[model samples]
Target: MRIHLVDGTYELFRYHFSPGNRDREHGATLGVVHSMLQLVQDGATHLGVATDRVIESFRNDLWPGYKTADGVPPELMAQFPMVEEALAAAGFCVWPMVDHEADDALGAAARKAALDPSVEQVLICTPDKDLAQCVTGDGRIVQYDRRRQKLIDHHGVVTKFGVTPESIPDYLALVGDTTDGFPGLAGWGARSTATVLSHYHRLENIPDAVGQWEISVRGSSKLAATLAANRELALLFRRIATIDYTAPTFEHLDEMAWTGPTPKFPELMAKLGGAHLVERTENLRRHRDDDRPQ
Candidate 1:
């Protein structure tokens, strides 16, 4: 069976900014939970959603400017705890990340789920560049961009980024991710960064001399000099983008499968002003019962 892992943090942000969700109360979190449940209803058996319980992760200590909750609105931040509680009450496996962020949890879960023999595929439900590193060659792990409705495999990564999935962290390091607050080396843009990193596969392996480059790329000399000058910073940035695959472990695929809502779902839904969800779930349960052979 295909195991689906979701980046709840990204989903919340997407829904918050989405046109259809702007005026709804707690719409982002409710929409995210609804969307995830729809996935299960549509045949996703094993599912997991990772959320950022605390915006600041250990990575913040590694880099002072890493993304944090400081700039997030009070309304948006307030929904995080509610989202986690709602997800848990719904009987979905929610990883409310504390020490690590949602991205790291998703990556770690993907790696762990990919190891299970019963899992036919592991679809990471996010377009986050950092999560791209988790894509594997065996087709076990892949990324699904819900907004674009694109399923990005290893080959797709190469097609989109001009480099293999393995080179993504390195590529992002050179191009920089403003969302994450890591400034890449100067003079590195998408094309130049892809051209060089595609060949070298990593920052450390790139030849120091421009003339030594095996593949001919534009502005090779300038790229080399920039790399030489900011080698340490570039590596540090890459480290920030790279996902840690060893955070939490899940040995069994069954651990992730949907088991229906928790006992406290009724009360929790009431608190979140999600009475509609509770009613729908009860109706769904009744329908299932009515369908069962007597």
Candidate 2:
């Protein structure tokens, strides 16, 4: 069996901003529910979605610039709870995180699910670069981009980022993630950071003195000086970038199984003005039953 961990916060934001989504109030929430049903239709047996109930997490205290809900449109922010309820009614495991962000929940779930020997694969379903750090080397854990129809394995991480999965936090710390709201150290761009991190594999391990470095990087002296000067700040950024795997996800792997929609699913869809989805959900349920063995 396989486990599919979704970044529900990302999905909500995606559907909300989509050009075709015209309904301001409930379009994104309903869209996410329908999308989860489609995942079931596409043969996802065990699915779990993680959502950011509160956009301001512990990271906000660590750095003043860390992302918060201040700029998100009230219309989109209001749907967080709505989508969580809709997915729960649709029989998908929903982890609505308050202190930890959705990324942490998904990462923790992926790590937990991958430990089950019965599970063949664990797919972290999101295009977020932060989740790339969660991908495992043996291919048991990977990242899936639903929009692009792409799979990113451990090798894919290296190919795209020029560093191993374990080095992503350090890489991001140096190169910075504008989306996550942290500015990495000065004199460290993608090429320089990736080149040095690919060799050192971590922030702490990188030599403070440029001359001690074995590999050649452009402007190595300035890069080393910048890193040495702000090493503590860089580490702080890394802490913010690293996903906290301790976030509680589930007690058992079977909890993630899709057992068809709950009784309230149709009513919730109706309330959202997605009556067509109600009928579609029933058809999908019947299809699942038919596929079952006697």
Candidate 3:
């Protein structure tokens, strides 16, 4: 059996800028709920969606420039609560992260689901780079970009980033993550970062001096000096980039089960203005029950 874990924050962001939803009231939220329902239609019985109900996570305190809800349209911000409520009402296990970011929940879920013997594969439904570290060696866990229909396995991680999954944080630390708002040291760019991290596999593991460096790189003298000077800062940035698996998402895997929508689903559908979604959900619920093992 396969379990599908979604990043609700990414979906909501994708829906909001999708060119069509701006006109419809609560359209992005409607599209999000509808998109999950389509997953059910496509044969995902065990599924979970993690949302960032409040955009300001503890990361904001760690770094002042960390992402916040400051500039997000009130319309988009307003839909977060409703999205959690509606997804819950629709019978999907929803983890609305507040203190931690949404990816933390996803990492926790991926780890827990992989421990289950019945779970043949776990598909993390997001394209975020930080989450790539969650990919496993056995290929039981992978990242899926639903928009592009792309699957990123462990090998794909190496191919795309020129480093192993374990090196993603180091890569980000050197190259800097613009989205997360930590500026990497000056002179570090994608190619140099990937080349060094690919060999060292971690910031700490890299030799501090250019003379001791094993790999050939362009402008190694300047890059090596910058890294040595900001070694402490680079480590802090890596810590920032790494996902916290121990963060509270849920107690057990069963908490993520998707039996069917709750009784309040009809009301939620009404509020979200997606009546057609309610009908499809009801039909799928009945059919799902019928197919369940007695």
lDDT digits (tens) for residues 154-207 of candidate 1: 998988899998999999999999998888888899999888888899999998
lDDT of 3 by residue, 79-174 (tens): 888888889888888889989889998998888889889999999999999999999989989999998999999999999999999888888888
TM-score, candidate 2, is: 0.99
- List runs of model 1 lying over 4 Å from the truth: 22-25, 249-251, 283-294
- Model 2, 230-284: lDDT tens digits are 9999999999999999997899998998888899988888889988888888888
Alpha-carbon local distance difference test for all models: 0.84, 0.93, 0.88
* Model 2 local distance difference test score: 0.93
Winner by TM-score between candidate 3 and candidate 2: 2
The candidate with the higher lDDT, 1 or 3, is: 3
lDDT of 1: 0.84
Ranking by lDDT: 2, 3, 1
RMSD of each: 2.2, 0.8, 1.3
RMSD of 3: 1.3
Model 3 TM: 0.97
